[model samples]
Target: MFRRTFWFTAGAAAGVWATTKVNRKLKQLTPESLAATAANKAIDAGHRLKDFAVDVRDGMAQREAELGDALGLNDQDAPELPPQRRIAAIENRTYPKYTYNRNEDH
Candidate 1:
């Protein structure tokens, strides 16, 4: 009789454990749970990507400053790069406009 009772108790415990596990798995598999998980992961990825972009921009600016120092760009009397390389007159050159006479078409 004691053996039967022990078996019965063990079976009930096993059944309860299995039911709890199944319910938890079902909750995780539901649409709302899946969508929330995906959204959280996406937000985490976006934050990481934004951080990477910020780091890259900072590195570029630092490298640019280092190069400028090497090239004497910070000196007051140093010739500038792009400003001195411009040709303003060629950019401003224009052609005379020709008017069409109606009497010439005839």
Candidate 2:
């Protein structure tokens, strides 16, 4: 009698555990859950891509400087406009605006 009861209790516990696992898996497979998982993965990929681009840019700049140094190039000789001069150039630009009058030549 004790052996039979022990086996039955074990079987019932196993069944409950299996059902709980299956239900959890089914919930994860639902459309909304799947969409959320995909969105999270996509966001992770975008961040990885942006990080890769920044790394590539920094590496390119470093390599260019190294090559310039090997070729005996001088970067300091290049002319650079000052901030005030640049701003003055931009401020000197003119734009014209026109208004139409209904009473004028129709």
Per TM-score, the best of the predicted structures is: 2
Off by over 4 Å in 1: 1-7, 76-106
TM-score of each: 0.61, 0.68
**Candidate 2, pairs of clashing residues:** none
List the lowest-lDDT window of 10 residues for candidate 2: 81-90
Model 2 off-target regions past 4 Å?
A: 79-106
lDDT of 1 by residue, 1-106 (tens): 9999999999999999999999999999999999999999999999999999999999999999999889888665756566556556667678899999999997
The global C-alpha lDDT for each of the candidates, from Candidate 1 onward, is: 0.93, 0.92
Residue-level lDDT of model 2, residues 10-87, one tens digit each, is 999999999999999999999999999999999999999999999999999999999988876755576776666434
TM-score of 1: 0.61
lDDT score at residue 25, model 2, on the 0-100 scale: 100
Candidate 1 global lDDT: 0.93
